[model samples]
Target: MKNSEEFDDSFMDNEKVVLQSIAEDLRTCLPVEAMLPSESLAVEKAQQNCKPTVHVDAFLYDEEAVDLLCEEGKMSRDYCLLCGSHRTAPLGFISHSFSALELRFLFQNVLPDLSGKMLVDVGSRLGAVLYGGCLYSSAAQLVGVEISAEFAKLQRMVMEKYDFTDRIQVIHADICTQTSLLQNADVVVMNNVFEYFLESSEQMRAWHCISQNVRKKGALLVTVPSVQEALAALQGKNGVINIHEWLEELPLDYDVYLGKDTDPESFKQIHLYRVL
Candidate 1:
């Protein structure tokens, strides 16, 4: 990873333009209805017509471009249309995507070069992490496991629209059932999936499954909450247990890269660990 001082801001300025253009194309496919009962045919047609010419390499090395893409990606979501009405309120799943700025810091500064590594995103909603990998890291493969068929389809469409099928793949299946992916992944990113998406028992099951299947010894695991917090919550319910038996926290001693408008404290919640 290069130092922040070594990077040129002009490169990011150029890439931001290309990334923003791509985002504009993706927004065309977002359904107008907030709570869609079914997939819209219009959305599909819009995606087919949207041909994103920008390549991932255009923004891969620019830190500022990450913030730009992240902001633009927010437009892809379907918002609640009836928030102010007495009969209906704005209804939709809460956004669970990580900021692109944080992702750039994680992959480019925290982890070693990912030239031949396989990066897997658990419960990948909207494929934000996958896109971050495609545009910021050199990982050989970027895989996203999503349980929702709709979300999975959306991710696939975005990948196709951007011509990223060569390095990105989305699997429409529960992460727990995808043991092969877990065991084979060199880097696994779990971004607030367990806390908001799963019940208490299911969360335990997920942790147990990952502990048993994920690559051992050297594999990296990134999570939104600290390992201590997760272990404490589990232990409080099940009595004292040794979480160290499964994973260990890796101190982030390097300087985190941030965009001009980004606050460094915003990413203090992120935690990195090494699989045991």
Candidate 2:
């Protein structure tokens, strides 16, 4: 037990160092103007307009009090692996921070042209994508589709907080099944939300909807957690998983750009698909 305690302390120390390094990198890469306004505003909007979390356990856990020490390579049993919560609700500060990094990467590398075109963010949560779009591009229309009414209202509120309501629109609809509602868009983004649909058929349908909705030459930016992470969860541990085979299974309408992080197990792996 003494040896185990020492090992745990060392592991936590190493984790802290890595996290600090990442935080520095992010601070350097992401612009100051690209971040969310304030936590008070976000929390207030969530509390007032978003779904009542009092009822949903499908994606909620009192992480402050909950002690579920996930073993090395083991899944976090306290939260939903797909949505990162036991309940289907808005994201927290940590999740938003990670997402902002990915968004910075997207803005810098993936879709450089954000000016004068309509951009659609399927499953946009609390206007994060809209904020990214507004920061990165001068796109005429930044439309966001969210299935959860609570979330849609919160996104609307968030847009108002940024005074971007006139430019960004949040619709209450599911993009997967309601393809007709999604008109042709120049850029369509689905960040870290694709893996939620565990069924292959559902994934295929989502692709179809995205393909049909996007312009012929438009760009599609989607993020999937590293295969290693997915495997680790199932095996009660985490590691990096290759997406080569996974890309092959996706629709042939677009050529997917695979992103490889220096550390594969960091959940930083991303894939970008541009529709042909």
Candidate 1 vs. true structure, TM-score:
0.70
Candidate 1's residue-wise lDDT over 1-276, tens digit each? 233444634346433354455444544555422213343432343344333111122112233443465477732213334566544332222225565566667666777788999999998766777877777778999999987787788779879888889999999997889999899999999876676456567677777777778855789998877767765667555344466777788877545545553546646667888877
Worst 10 residues of 2 by lDDT: 53-62
Candidate 1 residue spans exceeding 4 A from truth: 1-95, 236-241, 254-257
Write down the TM-score for model 2: 0.49
| Backbone collisions counted per model | 0, 16
Residue range 133-229, candidate 2, lDDT tens digits: 6665678888988766766775675566557877899888768765654556766666544443233344445655554555345455454543334
Candidate closest to the true structure, highest lDDT: 1
Per-model TM against the reference:
0.70, 0.49
